[model samples]
Target: MVAPLSAWPWENLGCFKYLLYGPFLAKVLYSRFHDQEASEYSWCLHILVICALRGLIHQIWSSYSNMLFLKRNFRIIEHGVDFKQIDKEWDWDNFIILQALIASMASYMFPFPANLPFWNTKGFIAVLTLHMAVSEPLYYLMHRYVLHGNSFFTHHHSLHHSSPVPQPFTAGLATFSEHLMLAVIIGIPILGASLMGYGSIITIYSYVLIFDFLRCLGHCNVEVVPYQIFKTIPFLRYLLYTPTYHSLHHTEMGTNFCLFMPLFDAIWKTLNGKSWELHKKIRSNLGKSGRVPDFVFLAHVVDVSAALHAPFVFRSFAALPFSPRFFIIPLWPLTLLALLMMWAWSKTFVYSFYKLTGRLHQTWVVPRFGFQYFLPFAREGINKHIEQAILRADKLGIKVISLAALNKNEALNGGGTLFVDKHPNLNVRVVHGNTLTAAVILNDLPKNVEEVFLTGATSKLGRAIALYLCRKRVRVLMLTLSAERFQKIQKEAPVDCQNYLVQVTKYQAAQNCKTWIVGKWITPREQSWAPPGTHFHQFVVPPIFSFRRDCTYGDLAAMRLPDDVQGLGCCEYTMARGVVHACHAGGVVHLLEGWTHHEVGAIDVDRIDLVWNAALKHGLRPVSSSC
Candidate 1:
């Protein structure tokens, strides 16, 4: 809850912040902007270079400092943890370069203020001071009224708040409109300064760099600055925006609005009293750092080959008495071997993976894991193994993880709800990766097909696909486990889609519908039910190892990807290039595109093209778009 403005610790210090920061920051920013003579490109280059430097301060220095603070001072609470990884999908590939490129374009189109030497040395300082001097009102209004106010949060701004715990670069997770609005907000002071003849080489560089780094620093959950620092300079409480202060806004939105200073919050009476205390409490319990996967794939294996040999194990156990002593002894070795094989096969571990290296520093942050993807049928052990893997990833600061195809079903009946239900303490997100699958299918649906038949329609992937199709008025003959299940799933489809959707309890009921896709492996009977000339695609895992005449096994393989984008068996990329499954590919696309939420059983239809295009550049073909 927020407190009264007069009750704020720094309320009386508003005058002090304006008085002190006015000239202090102005003098430092003046020489940088006014003294140097530079071309527009040089000015852009200066911004680009300073941005790199600020990145170091934000990502490396402050991150390391935050880590140290967590290590030294932060301790874990009973139900809470400190330095729990925030979902960070930002780097040159995902966000920074994109933002920089856009900024560069904007700057090139509308040049920055490159004014002459100050008529008076302190003359330009006033303009720079005036720029900051006006910050109190505008920053507060944009953040409070426009961002958190109403529908703005629902549509544009709240996307940034989607990640409860934000990382330094997670700040880039806003809607395109929000990002554009922010560019305007940040340029306000500088634009005003430019008008007053305060624009110089360093002015643009310092304002852009300092503003960028500070915004990132504020979001960094690591509270590196000791409370003593605040005591040392009590006035800083009013002037400087702390990491803890910004964190409060994310945790409980609407408290702190001013990006650079806290006095505005004090003046507006929207200050959070819990910010400093929670920060202190959280950091006190920081845990030790360790290696974690970029994602954790829940897994199990059904030995297609091993199942044939399984009768031996049961036969031996049934004949435990050994009617003939010699034969019984012989059977013992086979039983032991079978038990060993079964035990060995069921064990879980970090399986094959490919790493995406950072472009700027080659930082090894996103190491995508395949994690037991080749296995299936682990109900008894799946939960334990999945939990263990998530914990392991959390220890290493891995913010996001996900379950693979079969594992996803085993975990939550193919939904994220179960993970939240079972493991509430986990700070990590369990991405289902099905959202983009539906998107991919919908995006690439054959234009000639008026109706699509979907078998196993009650499963998460199938159900999601049905909803997406029905929304587009595509007729679906949906087959499910039972009439009850079919109706339940059908209820979720758009009411207007009754004419467009049909429910089928058996494969026989859907045969006439030409185009067919099975979200799960169908029984041999279902396969036999396929009519001649029907276009069929199998969208499940541990795929039908052999291709059928009318069926495409595995969505990615069905797409007939380009050489560089095809999988080499398991989820591991060949030469660490190409994507394994379309679901996994979708996850990578989300990260590279800087999406805020995890792509689960549902995806936005608009993003399908974007993910598809990204996959194409890396060698994936557009086969799905064709017949």
Candidate 2:
């Protein structure tokens, strides 16, 4: 029969065992000798033997696990397993042994007895245990109330979440600040117990070391403990540490904060309820049967569409001005070209519109896109021009006339007549008409009517009429569609007539003011003072208009008629100095300064005299004249 299997293996290793046992037994025997030197020597030798045996056992177990996984084709390397990720890799048993050795050596140097007077062993043990209990609770409270509640959590704790699924070693991979905080917490109790002369410090230190080692073991991703046992003895299971439980904490945060006990988390309710659910889901998804959803098909369609149409939509509007006659020819080539140009133009037009309106205005017919530079449009440019012209009239110490034709078709056909109203000063006359020709009738004013403002003349034909008036040497400001259009008209018009045609778009013409801003105190003395809010505040002022010089004493107080005030004729006032100072002093009637003029030195002396006279009649006093 085959020799006993166990005996066969032991017989071959018997000689090697004897070789190790002989030296160990000899040391033990030598420690009991009557000589102090021999006894000390033996004791040192025995300590080394025990440490070596423990290290051997640890290595054997680790190697056995590795080999078992290898046999099962479950290589940790294949799964990206890393040992450095484990936190707190201090060999607790070995550390304790080394500490003991150092302490023993120190005792010899001091010649102190192991059992010193005043150090009661039993009392020391009790005190040490109590210190640990108190320190743990304090640590928990500090973590919950301070670190987690304040901004510290955002800066410090957030770093840990950088890796959601962490390896074992990552547990101790805290920043230096975090490590220092831990050291303080641990040192407080350790130092307190040591200073109190409680039990043997060595034994107390041993317990602390063991607890720290257990914490490290828990963080390690090794499933050595049985799940069945954990289920059966619930209380004992809570006490025992496990890799799965700790791993869950790393993956799903806000859980498992306690290193030695779960009571702290339970009492504070900080334990994450979803930890178990997340762990189960992660594990199930990692299994062979799990499948990732296919989003590639949908993503491809979106990518292709964006690539094909983005450029076309962006370039269409810019081509509009060049191809004004594009719509006349509906052929694909012309149509395509028109669409492309419009796309480019629209980009700039929309941007400028939003800049002025503070609202994004888009049309379905106009393809939306983003680009640099905004071209002025009929809608925005006309309003802006009128506002500027009004301002200019005020600055030039001249009168303004505003005309509105409600019937667009009739105005275009020259069938409507003009409605004229003089400002309170009778210096500015507003002419409202449905037709350009009707507005042109203002040019036939009597010599005394120094300034004539024509409104409702915004079409191409209206601009031509304004140009004609300019040729006639009348200071004519015309509100048009856009700057681009104004420039085009200027290019085509006679040089002598161009200067007369002040191309104030409708937008600029609407902002003109004819009143002087004054304080409440001066109101009783003057009837021409304005208190603000009479003019359109939302209207955008153009660069050419001068609001400060254009605004009269009556406009600031809203005393001037709206029809007399040009809306879009000027730039915004830098500051309402006349009004601000007067308002502060409670004065209603501030001295009126004459309007700002586009051609300051060129303003007709007679026209200025007439404006001053008109303002005087309106109860405005010219206290001083810079002119």
Candidate 3:
């Protein structure tokens, strides 16, 4: 899936250096009065041109194959998970130069005939047979001994072992010393052919073409070779190597050391015995069409801390420089500054929170803006950042994104209508995630409670919660910017309980309130404000962003996420893993139910049971605690 092109660290630099080195090499060789050779400038030009074309073909073909798979089936390929790093294939660009050098060895120009017999013309058939015979034993020796025996060479060899699924360019990517050794290995066949008075440039070119093609095929994930053909010619199955055979050398690295032929591996007993069975299974699955997922959930929050753990941390901000043109001045500029500050402090992974379930479902944690500093001061720009994060989810093939914390406030009147309006064609749905939030809080409402304090009582969630609490015949203490806004509350709140609602400027022990609804970032810092036996139901982005004077991590240690919970709002605040905010718990509920459509604001009291029932269907139940 596309996770934004800017997300990759494909090092396409240093192309011009080689472009310049071509002329330099030709001049130096000419001055030394060396034997005549093909013009280096022409050679570099040809190599660079072909390399660029081949690179395009590789990217387009691989991406198309994946897209075709995803569209027809439910599951994405392993490489498609986070968009596999381009590095493995990208390092193989140097091979184009080797091809150019081999082409230069020709006594004449290219586009040579393909079907000349072994005794007639180039004698490639005979040379290819001899080369394979000689190279197989040498390949086995190099791989089994020198490559693995020497710690220095093994260091280079270990890189190839990193990716379980090798790609087209994976064959050529190696350290310079390793490349030199590999060059000598290839040179053996060429030098021997030249000395034997047979094999010309046509032989070398044909051999290189077939050799490169076969190596690429060895890494390609497709298992198109017919099983029946191998069965019919049992000896042929043992004679020729398949992609599955080479893949084992990467995954089960101690086995399958021989290349092209399985003779050495058979003799040495290093051939992977399980490859045949595995290949048959893969081929069988490919024939069954594609595997689709159940659902996709994306989490959007503004967390700068996670950005500190990214690989190539500086590269994470590569798009920030060009962002100002697309965005208003101060917004993009401020975000750029914030990213720099975070990086200066050694932050990383502001990239993405990638995870997939055993059920083949997908989930993502997408960060908005750079950090918390932009959350308030750059509020206008924050929406764009939220949109961008959702857009990133769209690129990741996620179908829905849940707005978290302050990000929820940026949605259309907090309903996400503005987001839908801006991007009408977006595949990833914008979810406010408030329905589940309301469900968890109401489900946990304490019985026999006559009085309750609502901190930030006039805020959307707080007001809805406060008014609902009043409907339950519970006395509500409304703590707002202005307690006098009681006129608004009196107008909106239930008439029978309006008189029970107290407008308070400050918390007083005399209120005798045993329960409080802590707002976003609100903490009764003074111990007197929260009298002994006072319990709170915090429902903020981080339900425990702050704590009262007497509290510690240990004080809130009893909080644990319910069985159905995944994204815990209090995750960053606590070392304990299971603590969740009433907000994030809502998203988890949606994920558990496979609901894709947006559910915003509070669920009506009458319909609260519907949400509760859905949660129960997913094996979820409220943790019955007032605090």
Q: Global lDDT of each model? A: 0.53, 0.34, 0.53
Model 2 lDDT, full chain set: 0.34
Model 2, position 115, has a per-residue lDDT of 39
Tell me each candidate's TM-score. 0.40, 0.29, 0.47
* RMSD to native, candidate 3: 14.4
Candidate 3, 537: how far from true, in Å? 2.5
Reference-based lDDT, residue 280, model 1:
56
- Give the residue spans of candidate 2 off by over 4 A: 1-79, 82-128, 144-150, 154-168, 274-627
Tens digit of lDDT per residue, candidate 3, span 546-595?
A: 45544321121122334433211122223233333444445545666667
Higher-scoring candidate on lDDT, 2 or 3: 3
Could you tell which candidate, 1 or 2, scores higher by TM-score? 1
**Model 3 off-target regions past 4 Å?**
1-306, 309-377, 388-399, 410-415, 421-428, 483-490, 509-511, 523-527, 541-582, 591-597, 601-606, 621-627
Q: What lDDT does model 3 reach? A: 0.53
